[model samples]
Target: MPTLFSKYAYYFNQLCEFSPNRLQAQKAKNVAPVRYPTPVQKNMNLMVDFKVENKVIGYSLASKQHAHGNCLVHFQSTINRILKPDSFVVPRETVAISICNSFFTLGSSPTDFVKTKQGGKPLPEDSYFTYKMVTKHVMIVLYNSEGAEEQLAGFVYYPQLLTSRRVCPNIDETAMALARITYSSDNGPEMFARFCKKTQRDVIVKIMNGGMSATHMDYNYILLEQNYGSCSECNAFHQEKMKKEKKEKKKSITEKAASKSKSKSEAATATETANSTVTPPPKTAPPKAVDSDDEYDFGN
Candidate 1:
């Protein structure tokens, strides 16, 4: 049996062969390789072949050098012919290949990977969290053999991470409170209903506005539930955030020095003002000389 690594490598090589430049080069030499509508391969017991539909999809080239061409291949597993169809499970290799195919089909750029929109918000740039989330979703879709569009349709308005009922436990209560406070007329009941709905929508939008970062935490929580190990992505994100916070919070040496100098100058000015405001004791100079002469005459 071919190892998972071998399978990925095989598919990647197959994709490269279908590159437009390579095809054109072959044609120019009058030695074009045979092409198949569905490329199939056989495996021994407990094995199933994947029939991949290959095509070249046009995308904005990330660089001028890539203007030559790019290939997009979609792999569909045909498990109907598996020796043990009832017991067979889709391999992780299939999921990995699907991700790779989707990536290349879109474009070879960070922006291409970020085109997916979650909760009406465009996904941020690629990261470990995003990569794992994408992989998990793809795995689910493949395992169920469901249309990716149907499985991902919910994410159009809300993220999969927030699918649980408990994520926003107070949403209804908060909406109700807002509605009651805003509408206190004779048609209060009807107005309350409308207001509540609007409030709920607004809350969801607000959550999604900050959802990207929150979702990272949620993803890690889910992973923790499954196993005791900590998420490396979450750890790395936290460490990076700490680094940024420290940098922002730290005072520069120049600022400290300036503050010290200002304080010293103010102290000196205060001391001078205090000294000038005081009255020295009145002079007793002439009285002392006269008192000595007067005391001598009285004694005589």
Candidate 2:
């Protein structure tokens, strides 16, 4: 039996040699779609995928080499590897949070996260993430809503035990709570909004009161919600929302200008008509002199 490392190495060999079928997505150019590996190949790669907030985050890789942690980082200095800075690259901090979110949510022992779970039918997860369970552990319970007749989806876990939930508790709570409310009909938007506000207030206050040396878990609005949304994609969502609002405001201003222009035109037209009606109109030019019959005709 190949060791995990050996198996990954084998998969990596395949990934390196793996060529995707070319697809002609656009015309007018000699271009084809890059073929992706079979599901089997992708799944095999996911064996080491990382998790965040019960979400799997796939890091765009420079190669098919199976790697985790710093080994898995996006760019390779030695390899002269590069990715578009704007590419969907996640920050290291965000990556860390994503893993924490998943580990704690499952209540899986940190040790399990660290070691591979053989014959374990792992839950369906994102393809981008892998988990490593450490031996030490601490459990923290965060609620979507607690002491409510219908408790919304919340999280419970220990950071020393799990990495995914450690970085961003608020974000995950907000997301899961909303999901439960939306799909399950167990909670509502209002419930979520309230929960978010209260929870944010609580967490923020705790952080503030704790002084500057607050625990990583105690502060960072972003870290708090990393599980809910901290990855680059989630941040994009936030940015897009702001852009939409700005567009709407600009549209409103344009509409107002158009409306004002129309009003001004109408008023000017009305004033012109009033002036013509009220004030004497300029006298029409005197009728052109009749060809002066009286003016001597030369041959008369």
What TM-score should be assigned to candidate 2?
0.21
* lDDT score for candidate 1 against the true structure: 0.27
Least accurate 10 contiguous residues by lDDT in model 2? 19-28
| Candidate 1 Cα misplacement greater than 4 A, ranges | 1-226, 230-232, 252-258, 276-281, 288-300
Q: Pairing residues by index, what is the TM-score of model 1? A: 0.20
Error of model 2, residue 233, in angstroms = 1.9
lDDT of 2 by residue, 1-300 (tens): 569887677555543332111111111022221222112122233333433333322322222333233322322221133123423444332212212222223323221222123367563342222211111111122222123232111222221112222222233233333333333343321222211232332111111222222111122342222222222332333346457878999999999999999999999999999988896668888877767666667776
| lDDT, residue 44, candidate 2 | 31
* Model 2, CA-based lDDT: 0.31
TM-score per prediction, in order, is 0.20, 0.21
